[model samples]
Target chain A: MRDSRGMRAFFQVGGIVFALALTTVVLVASKAPPFAAYLNIALGAFGSWEVFSNVLVSWVPLLLATSGLLLTFTVGLWNIGIEGQITFGAIFATWAMRSLQGGGTDPAFVIMLSILAGALGGILWAMLAGALKTFGGVNEIFGGLGLNFVATAVNLWLIFGPWKRPGIASMSGTVPFDKALWLPTLTAQSRLSPSSIAIAVAGIVLVYVLISGTHFGLRLKAVGRNPRAAYLLGIPTWQYMMTSFAICGAFAGLAGAIQVTAVYHRLIPSISSGYGYLGMMVAMLVNYRAALAAPVALFFAALNVGSIQLPIVLKLDSSLAGVLQGTLVLFVLLAQGAREFFARKGGKR
Target chain B: MRKINRFILVLFLAAVSTVAFGQSSNFTFGLLMVGPYNDHGWSQANYDATQYVVAKTPGTQMIYLDKVNPADRPGTTASQLAESLVAKGAKLVIFSSDDMSDEAVKFAQAHPDIFVIMSSGDQVWKDGKNAKNIPNMVNIMGRMEYGKMIAGVAAAITTQTGQIAYLGPLANDETRRLASSVYLGAKYAWTKYLNRDISKLKFKVTWIGYWFNIPGVTSDPTQVADDFFNSGYDVVVSGIDTTEAVTEAVKYAAQGKRVWAIPYDYVDAIKEGNAVSLGVPYFNWGPAYVSAIKSAMTGKWTSHFEWNGPDWKNINNPDTSAVGFNRGSVLSKPAAAGVDKFIAELSKGLNLWKGPIVLQDGTTYLKDGVAATDQQIWYLPQLLQGIEGQSVSK
Candidate 1:
């Protein structure tokens, strides 16, 4: 036990050091100024109120996706299908927006309907993985991956064949959603909004409560820690697992809807903006705690926001933040395992 | 244990030595690319041309970043790269993409003393707009639409159904006008030359929302092309980046049937997929880039919107563009001869906008014998006659 603990500590320290070394290697290999890039990231991400708003804009989707992931994570499920779920959410929102076009529909109703559609879209997608795991014995990771490809194909068919914008597919995205339906902007020019902030905060609180403050949370933890034990205790393990996935899927969907309603004002091809995977990173970095997720997500958001400045200030690649963030996460993982190693080493010594 | 320590020491030294050697300055000119230098479309061609220029010029070196997504590094702009290059003592710095527009402007604004060249920018024009041109900045773009029209002619001639589809990256005015010019060229080929009714020649256009494929979110031009070909359209034109159009056509070709494709901005795109390609409208960004850098070096850098293309006197002539066509595509003998005649007429100033032009919605764009101004052409938001599509007001 002492040897194993020592090895764990060694791993913890080694992982952090290795990640930092890897980051340095990346910077040197790319011939970029790592220090300047880091400085730019800091300034761009958190240097001012205006920049903080940019961080918030990036954080909204991240927090939402991560909060959803917290549910599945609590139950020991890895729902890698968040990206596809987000895409489906955006697609569903687009369909709702299209139907309401020229109907002079109430903007609030449109927003609510779109969000509902997104949740439904995500839940439906997650059900596929859930069914496969519960019935067919297929792995969720591979199932989610396959479903992602299918969602992409379906999105393509809808946009190209039936829903292609009037003349050409534009980089600007679906003919901008009706101005009336747009999520109210913070300023006339900025996409950041008060409602988005509220939504992000609420998503964190709600997920925290559902995952940690309720019996469901206890059941989830039990199921995750030992599914067979939970099943023996008369708990329906499959139901809880599937519900966790469905809940996670819904959160991811809400993220997509918020992206459309708030940031983009219309569905663009890449509106998900890799937020799903980034959210996964956020979830893991925070050790899957709903309470810890918001600040961590904000940290990552700041990194993303800061990266935009590097291109302007340093002409460095924006991926520098990715390198740094990857390093930080790797370090965090190392730090978590260090205590075990120290105790074991003390015993051995 | 002693041998292991020696081996480790030797390995560490080797790594350090190798890295030191890798930073050696061999070439003088440095290229700061915004995206991957090997995307096989926009940035790749620019990278290729830089290598070509370096190879031909001799004693010149080129360094670039390939597959550098905008999100890769935060808070950095093209100007920062320019400054970094300047600090490294590079003689010239070239900003490769238009997304670098704001960054380039900021960099040029800050570093007025440094030599800067921005590709596909309009800031170089408009007196007092640019700080780089206060002494050392120049802009380079292409008459991409000129080659696009040539590809259009090929599409019109090669199409078995006389129906052609232009897949664009955006619905912006630049994309719109190019698509319009292509249709105009096709219409000229089909009606005036082939003696077919203009109404019978079907043309449709769709944009691929952004510049690249966004996995799981929307339709890609490659998939869009597949849909178009499946819908009985024969000739496909792409106004987006990548060899997606050519690649998609090649897939269709493997079934022993041909669906001709016209590609934009790179000549090598046609070479990428041999089956259904009908050449490409290439951008010769090198000449303009060279001229800009030279101007900056000699202190003659001045801002002007330069739109130069094949000397037309010998368009098939390879003297001018780093962005022109390859030789001997599979146009019919008659079509080939017609193209030659058309080139001559173009050289003599055949305006595609010689109108009585009407938009798809039947709005009069220009009266007969009237030539639209560059601004008018550049900002054209509507489809021309023979295009069956709508422009949404939202």
Candidate 2:
């Protein structure tokens, strides 16, 4: 049984490699040399220690968002509004910073409080969706998506209305916070802050342990498989679902807080970035496996950091990175389907 | 879920189709945009000019990256994109739009070997906010103030109810100056030519606070245009990047509302507005870009700030003009003739900068009879006094 399972995993990996190789061939024949472009991507992403450090900066948010998504996915919940949760997190964090702007409080203490505020913001948004799903009989997807719009409106309103700069209003975003209020960067050059990356790693570890080792994880899985059966077994399915959303939202919010404090050093309209959406993609690509989310999130982040070379060297759109990632997921799913079909056919024979 | 899957498929194909084959060349140039390449307004105009420059000048290869703004790319940055472009062998790079000022400054400082040109950038302007004349970077902008003035005149002449609207984009000095120029032209013609009171002209501005529309982040220009027409404003002069004003006006006209719009940036924008388009005040960046590319090719590239004006003889000439006002087919004969008359006066140096100019805060900007200098025009602090709208969000 072990040998058979190993063979299946190897085939699955081989199929993905084959699909990617085919895409590279197609790219080279029609337009750019995929080999040279791929080389550029590697050199840009990981050529030097400094460049790799920048990759980790992007990876932090991707990892955090994916961690939250992995939890919801485990419970068979599609929390599409993680994007809104992220925005609320950043907005809440910004509120804390702006509120404490002139205070003589310790910088480190303020940062901690701000991050906590961000978490509270994320939890509040997530709870709304959870309540809607549980009490109002609404789908999490619709609730989350609607909340995303509201969050975006709130962000824009803050920037263009109440939180607008003193002398001028611009799409350039609100005035950057003071340098002293900034999240401590790992170095003067890269945007990476060591604390944010540490939080992301801790999030990954927590997710791995929670999903694989605990009885709570087993119960969540049972509820996902059949809520009626889990209910018959005395499991409070609704509570599990709500807990999953709350936990997921907190992680996403932490990522958003880091975004405001570290990335731009100010709340811009795009403070949420696309990390929430990208994290959803990462979760789906990994088939909602928390254990697989870490490496995959890093890979996605690296692809984005590296594909800047597409437009530079080949006159190609940098969105090629997204295309490759999507193709990988599609091919992996197809291969998995094929394997299941063959196994059933062989068993019947 | 199915819709999202389809959207991803379409995005993938779109990305594939945008791939331009790299060609061997003696000179290569990079153009960056903060929005889509075919946005039909600001970025499209630059994209067309870049193609024109590359095709007209042989031995030159061109690579351009659109949607380079941080808002567009979540994981990367504009400066990083610029670095990759330079690494790709772009001898000269043009960072278009005002938002890229910080990115351009940082990139230019780091890469002294590469020449940088910032379009509509205030960084190199002598009196502009955050002004800095970096050795390798040049700032180039069209004399769009005159074009906007002509657009304003057209609106003022065309309005039946004396209610003209200015659909503005953001509150930067560039956008502020552009929007205010419309008010100036409308007031100038309404009082001097139409024998009407300036205040009665109802020249109001509604700022959308961005070059192009980003859903939820900026007020939708289409909605703003609809609101203007619904509230008695019959002529809308676009100061934003997109052709939403023209499109919205065309829709209102079909529904029996007699509304007109004048688009900004592209001369051909009138095509979308059809019967509702009065005209468009456009920037012809070809003349400027071609010269910059030529200078770089000849090893004579040096940073110089150029604020170019329209060719007086033929402002709409496809070849050598910095700015042009293209009159739409819907313009009446009298209005068209009046537009011509206005242009004629401008050709003989009709300076709108003459004093008696008051600021929005009721501060006197230019004393009577004193013409405004380039420095004064380049760094307008607020909307001119008579314009209706908030200069700052507060």
Candidate 3:
């Protein structure tokens, strides 16, 4: 109990330091007056219902992708190909939606097929990494990274070649989806949809229960902590690792599906907004806790939503947001180390 | 249930300001830039234009977001970003990229009152009737590719080896057209003036698949130039948005080779003593942008699409698009004369798009006096038959 409490306290201090470091970087690199600019960011992100809605627009995908990442994290598998998985999901979902167009299929059924296709797309993408990791004796990271390049190539090809929109000279992109398929906007101004938000929230809850309260969760954690020991204890360690990766990929796919159906309503050259990477950041920042993923994801989402105002209101470079984000994550890591120093100092006292 | 209700309430509030924007004049312009304003490319040009409007115009303030990747493009819908600018008191919003077309169209569709000016988009005219061109949304693009053809003419005339190379960003029609224009210009110079057959000149196009660097992968276009130069190519042209090609030319020039370069977009890129650094096919977006904003401010928003180009009289003018040039530090009298003669020929009545066009694969794209189809130009995947080098197939 004391250990867990100490860890929690460590995280708390880490969060504060990370925030301060992020602010310091922004303060130094500000293009507009710093405080006023930050105020605009804050106001733009959460000062009104409008700003928060913007945050929600960014939040839904981050929540889904990060929560999905948490499952794989528990199993000690790093599925960096979440980016590719997200792309595949969007691609497959697009294919499914396009195929079902004008078929007179129920809209509800069409949506389900789209979501299911996204899951399948993610699974297929993740399984390649899994196969390379399990059978080919490659590390998951390298496998996932390779798969990412392949997915990018595939996506570009699709947009440029077969799925090229008629009469449009464009960067790689597919034809726009029907309006009936577009996820209705939550408000006149925002892209947030209730179904997307619900799906992400539900996914987080289900993943939370799966990773924290189930036998699979326990075995995955055991494998993550000590794969050799778990293997010796008759656990199918490889299967669990693959399973975690698949689950992570599926969650990423779900995020991608929502990006297409709810957010973009069309498959552009890049649909995965680096949400996969951002999710990885959130997972790392929370140390891969399922419960911690949502709040952390929301915080980053708020930052993203609010940062749009930074350039306009402050005239600061938008890259400042990236510097701040990198600082926050770095300081959080530093805070983890600082906690130990502070504890050692306190003990001596 | 209560939490969901609160979430819904917050979302509703977030949307209220977007709708409130159409009914008001006190608006903020949300400038969503795809790259850093300091990138010295398309984004920088837009940034300079935005700054120009801000400095010259009163009662108007602009909000800008830069380095927006394609993924972030949707979340910050052009409409919402524009509306946010509107809420912040900007009367006009400018999205600076052809990539922003879909977002711009969607935003323009949703917000009828907010004036939106999207750069390099062809859809504002094609889809105008469907989106119902509310006097508020307009599309403006410059025919910089024509300027590229002019630069191509200069490069071809000055080349000692007669073998030229083009380093393009993507294989899309825009890149293809730009490259095609250059090839046409080169062909014109080589055939009409230089007394060289097109079959002897080697014009190769290599696409690096992305605008800038991707982590862990080297995106040094200068190294790409080295590969071409080492292989005996003399003049190199760039079709990408970045100055990487010009930088490559500078490096190659410093290496004591007489290799020349012609760059695209923005002036002042030719400064590294590579006077063989021909000129830039730049888009001067300021005049049109200022005019559009003034139109919006005066409630005279129109739905016309303008494709401005280097008309000489209008080239350096505020709104008319112009290609800039620095003659050459090393240009010999003859080479300079050649450039002057070609620029005059182009300025007088030379149509680069004049038909009798064929693809690298020997397919006719245009017959004499026929305009190329939007499909042919938009989906140009290969180089013309006469150009050197192979279109990358990976």
Candidate 4:
């Protein structure tokens, strides 16, 4: 067991080294100074208090999305519809804020209510996917993918149709809400909201504790490992799966709500900003271990924020960050597979 | 030892102050383009204008990041990106798209010391409806109405089939007025120049919902252009920021069809369509951008809105004109003469926006002989009558 554990660590380190080397080759091929590109990304992310705060602002939603995905992954379910769920949450939050903005309601109360509405919106959408999987005999992956497209369509329709700015229908998005409707931030100019950071940290902690230290978590693992066996043991398989979907959806909804109130302050067409998909990547990179999810999500967020410097400084496309991220995840997964293959071969010999 | 240390400290202070003084004279302006810098349309015009400014001003340098829209640069707002530019020693930043109005306002308000140039925005215009009191921000837009009018005359005279279609960007006040200006010019040429019946000319506009194509989010301009040609509309005027209309027209022309396109925004857009092109109404942003950057450099910057029009003496002059129309290669001699005559008439104060104008809903927009004010034209509430397209975004 000790030797195998050592081997796992060795392969994981090897995977990271390989990812860096591959990224270096790409930088060299693009004729960019590889060391400078890496340094720029590092400086862009943590060079100052302001840019670092921006990283935290990005980290909030990403961590929330990863925390949510951890629950669905724990249940052996691939909730690709989290993207749609996030979009629905943003829509619902925007709807609530728009309805309450001029209604003489307390601003704080309205923001809270809107966030709650977002959560409910996410639950409803996720339930539809859950229902499709549990009762309609459709696979979750396909159902989730279909729902994501539907969510995007609905978002575009609202932005271009009923919710469009008066006398304007452009992809710039709906009219921004008043300053009173914006979430309280750490500074007048910064997008970082302490409340949002606290909520995201709390969310990951709740997920970690739930997955590790509770009866529901143990039963969830049983359901994930073998639903038929779990059902025979009276674990109530479908219920656990649905419950996991709902919880994940709630977290995704909060992420969307934060995006509206704390970040954009309007219903932009790409409001979710691909955080739902990025979170899935973060979960996979961490192998769905809840404890390591926050740090990894932060690293991903830093990569995103830092890459903006590539275009500004090096004249390189910022999508190089995506390449690095894809390679890192691919190599880690490949390393794990290889380790298992070698172990099985040795045992057979 | 103490005296030697004091001398070293004084030397260090002198070196730092000299560096700071040297940096103050060297002006760096950052630009955020809504599309690729070399897109051959709106973004390219602004990019080239910045390059022009660098050439005209001795100490000026430009730093730019294109594709600044939300879809392309996910997780970063235009304001946040501007801050990054500021960190890289930019004292002034130009947000060069109307799509970035909100973020531009946010950035200007956040960094009052940083000069901001918001092209194609009216937020700083004191008389504008959406005006804000942003002291450090200036709004600049060219009077492309005149250019579009000239494009209309060229199309009016060149079309073998009297049907003209407009490939509109999105439903907005700016787009509506521009599309309406095309109609007004076309009507003037069709009746007054060609001596044709008004009812015989067909003018239609189809909005693709953005300044340029974004795959699933907008109607494909290539498909829309084909639809226009397939349905027998012989002249298609493109208002989007890309060359799709001309590219598609080239395709249809290759098939032995008599199709022509009028592309908008950049000066060389006619070159893109070559023989099938029927002139382009382009913004010459160099003079305006040079003046704006110089003002910012010399500390003469003050918030204002400029709606500069063409330099009629030489409309195609790169140094003086704010807006100009370049006739395409395939324009017949007679059609080119008609376009020149139309410009002469415009220079002589002939206003087509005058009077008896009606909305698409049959409501009167202007009474008889009543001319439109800048405000009236800028805030056009709906598509004008005789244009078959959505008046408002329902």
lDDT of 4 by residue, A11-65 (tens): 8888888998999999999997666677778888998999999999999989988
Indicate the residue-level lDDT of B354 in model 1: 66
Off by over 4 Å in 4: A1-3, B1-25
lDDT of 1 by residue, B283-381 (tens): 767666666655555667666666576767555444465346553365567767766777778879988876799887888999999998765775576
TM-score of chain B of each: 0.86, 0.92, 0.82, 0.94
Taking the candidates one at a time, how many backbone clashes does each contain?
40, 1, 16, 0
Could you tell which candidate, 1 or 3, scores higher by lDDT? 3
What's each prediction's TM-score? 0.65, 0.85, 0.87, 0.95
lDDT of each: 0.71, 0.83, 0.73, 0.90
Q: Worst lDDT window (10 residues) for model 3 chain B?
A: B18-27
Best-to-worst TM-score order: 4, 3, 2, 1
Better of 1 and 3 by DockQ: 3
- Tens-digit per-residue lDDT, B48-164, candidate 3: 787777666675566676766564443555556666666676656787876666777777777776678877765656533233444667878777656777777777787889788
- Give TM-score values for chain A, per-prediction: 0.90, 0.95, 0.92, 0.98
Q: What digit string (tens of lDDT, one per residue) describes model 2 on residues B1-394?
A: 9999997777655544333235346888899988788877888889889888987898888787889776778756666677666655688898988777666776787678888999987676656566776878888999999999998888898999889888988876777888889888888888888888777888788888688788767789999999999999999999888899999998999999888999989878788867999988998998789988898788777777889999999999878899999899999887898789999999998888789999999999999999988878877888898888977764
Residue range A226-306, candidate 1, lDDT tens digits: 999999998899999899889888887888887777766666545567787888888887778788899989888887767
In model 3, state the lDDT of residue B265. 65
- Candidate 1, superposed: residue stretches over 4 Å from native: A1-4, A10-72, A75-275, A281-349, B1-36, B52-61, B68-95, B99-116, B123-139, B316-319, B390-394
**Residues B1-394 of candidate 4: C-alpha lDDT, one tens digit per residue:** 9999997677656533422332464888899999999899999999999999999988987788899987787778999999988887899999999989999999999899999999999999999998999999999999999998888888888888899999999889999999999998999999999999988999999998788998876889999999999998999999999999999999999999999999999999888879799889999988988998889888898999999999989899999999999888799999899999999988889998888999999999999999999999999999898999987665
